[model samples]
Target: MSILDLFKKKPKVNGIIKYLNLEGWWLNELSDEEREIILNIYSPMGSENSIIEGEICSSSQTQLHFFWGLIGWFNKPELRHIAYKLISKAETFIDKSSEPLDVHFFYSTKLEVFYKDRDLRPNGLELAIQSCEQQIANAPAAATAFKQKYDGNLPAHKGYAQLAIILEKQKRYDEAISLCEKAKSQGWAGDWDKRIERCDKRAKA
Candidate 1:
């Protein structure tokens, strides 16, 4: 990446570097090519040649901001399978020794990826569910777990809300309602009443 950095790299490359540079990120477990692909998916440039020896590059914004990361990447149905592969591997490679909240956030990302990747949905949902539940139980607040001179960047995972939405989508409306209720009790910042109302209506329907 250092040599790649010597040249003007694309947004994808820059984004991957940012993700890897995140404290406790373990990008070494992945190959250079794989890292390029992971970042490239987040690039708004669609598909293009991967960074090559001495190739000049450019960057841009698209339908979504690059800050959206895998969230934006996962929505591309054509690239969805690739995202599943990369995210699953990233989940393994992520350093658990990082700040607990960061760890929780990455694991919460798995819930979003699995829920969105309909083909890979069934096998991984339970893992995401359990992980998120534990996260909210343990580190329910960002400041509580992060404990640094606060930047707006590192915040608590919306584990309760994310899990509730997944549960709602799965038509486990009762569980969804219960989860939203728990989020409200825990003081998660979201419209829980509305979510609970929607879930209750669905449950009855």
Candidate 2:
């Protein structure tokens, strides 16, 4: 390639860096200042430390989509894949080096994101169900913060609520109702009765 061509060409970055290189895709049209602000914000998020710290809960949502515009999932379908890749990279290190509570929170937040974008991705809902269910089955306690650290609103069985809500959305009303009932039996701190009642009304109607 000629010297001028080399200079004009964008740098080829791999892994997480490529995903943030909006210059080639989305940011070329944006002003230099606009691009700089976005890059400054997102570049840190893609770093190893920031990614590992991304734990999702109702009180403290995941960091991946702190910039809501970044997730424009339906408009920019590629963004979700970028998110999935980042999450996958973190998963490789979760069991290897992360605390059990951190791993638990990661899965919880992933479950929320997958289900939230169920319409965009073919396996979104399925993955969401599995994420919450896996946490509920294996490490139900880890998702909780009993010390009132980040709001102990739904300790020990938040996954149950998440999974049941997804099931409810899918119109599997009976399954949703049953799951809520189970949470009620376990003494979870959620409006389980309300959930069951809503599902029952929907199922009957």
Candidate 3:
């Protein structure tokens, strides 16, 4: 409460300011200095934007919208790293959001992140799956939304492919094979047959 105490404390940067800056960057607000600061702050959760949920009532949904924007807006192959950082930056906020996590977006986007730059971080895949499961557990209703969406006659169900590949990597062959079979039965296209074949061979060995 003292004048010296006030001077000693740094002015708290507003979360909205950071979010808006990111938004501006998305809109081609290209300032190298500011962009570098934004990237550094987000890359390591060095800012309140990552840790503290802002007063935005729809914080969770807003974050997802922003992430989707980044994913779509940065479609060029060369911008992959920037896209990954923007997506990764949302992880902590996704975890801390009080609202039900957007399960479909969470699963799909993380899967995209996983394959987009597999070795971006040493434990990225594990963390992605852990976050997916945690968010689902925390927000059963939102999880059920995705479940219902992908449940029946889902053609070329990308979700199955993503989740199965993770299980396959973990050497859970039976689960992976079972998932492929389910997807095939549901009329999904793609390499379900090849995936099943691989999993079967692995299980036999």
Predicted structure with the largest TM-score when compared to the true one: 2
List pairs with backbone clashes in candidate 1.
none
**lDDT by residue for model 1 over 1-205, one digit each (tens)?**
6876769643333333343343223244545665556656544465454322223344443211222345446646665666556555555543445445545555565556555544565756676676577567655444455545454444434678778878988999998888878767655567789989998988888
Query: Which residue pairs in candidate 3 collide?
Result: none
| Global local distance difference test of model 2 | 0.56
Compared with the true structure, the alpha-carbon lDDT of candidate 1 equals 0.56
TM-score per candidate, in order?
A: 0.51, 0.53, 0.46
Candidate 3, which ten residues in sequence have the lowest lDDT sum? 44-53
For each candidate in the order shown, give its overall lDDT on alpha carbons: 0.56, 0.56, 0.56
- The TM-score ranking, best first, is 2, 1, 3
Report model 2's TM-score to 2 decimal places: 0.53
Write one digit per residue (lDDT tens) for candidate 3, span 133-164.
Answer: 54334433444444565565433444666767
Scored against the true structure, residue 94 in model 1 reaches a CA lDDT of 39
Over 19-128, each residue of candidate 2 has an lDDT whose tens digit, in order, gives 33322433244455544444444544334522113332333322223323232222234345555544554454444444546656566656656777777678877787
lDDT score at residue 82, model 2, on the 0-100 scale: 52
